[model samples]
Target: MKVLTANRLSDGIAVWYADGGWAETVTRADIAHDKAAEDRLEAIGAAAAANNEVVDVN
Candidate 1:
């Protein structure tokens, strides 16, 4: 249930993290078990933000 969520930077489309990237479906969600795991996921989100690939990920 703990998966990263964000809006695509290009058009602000809703998105989620799956496998090693962002996806358009919850079915592709990358679940996180704990804070540490979430932090790892956060790293990906941060990278996306820095690259202008996503925004407000959590």
Candidate 2:
């Protein structure tokens, strides 16, 4: 399984990709159970980084 994560650019808060936005907790984080899902999450993370919404995406 995999979860997209990053720190908020404004306050450096740890966040996880949930639904269609960043969440402060992992309980509701979007889980990637396959390669395709993982790829989608990675793309979201990359876009977030490019928009300066988050950093340290993983």
Candidate 3:
């Protein structure tokens, strides 16, 4: 399993991808249970980074 995480570029606060956006905590983080889900998370992370919303996504 995997969960997408990153730091908000604006305030450098840790965040996790939940539902369709970033959340301050991990309790509701979106879980990737397979390769396809992982890929989706990666793409979302990349887009978030490209949009200057987050950094160090993993």
Instruction: Give the per-residue Cα lDDT of candidate 1 at 12.
Output: 89
Cα lDDT tens digits for candidate 2, 1-58? 9999999999999999998999999999999999999999999999999999999999
**Segments in model 2 whose C-alpha atoms lie over 4 Å from true places:** none
What is the per-residue lDDT of model 1 for residues 1-58, given as tens digits with 9 covering 90 to 100?
A: 3889999988888999998888999888999999988888989999989998999888
The TM-score that candidate 2 achieves is: 0.99
For candidate 3, write residues 1-58 as lDDT tens digits: 9999999999999999999999999999999999999999999999999999999999
Assess every candidate by TM-score: 0.87, 0.99, 0.98
Assess candidate 1 and give its lDDT: 0.90
TM-score, structure 1 vs. true = 0.87
RMSD of each: 1.1, 0.3, 0.4
Clashes of each: 0, 0, 0
Between candidates 1 and 2, the one scoring higher on lDDT is 2
| Model 3, C-alpha of 13: deviation from truth (Å) | 0.3
Residue 51 lDDT, candidate 1, scale 0-100: 92
Candidate 1 all-Cα RMSD: 1.1
Query: Looking at candidate 1, what is the lDDT of residue 57?
Result: 89
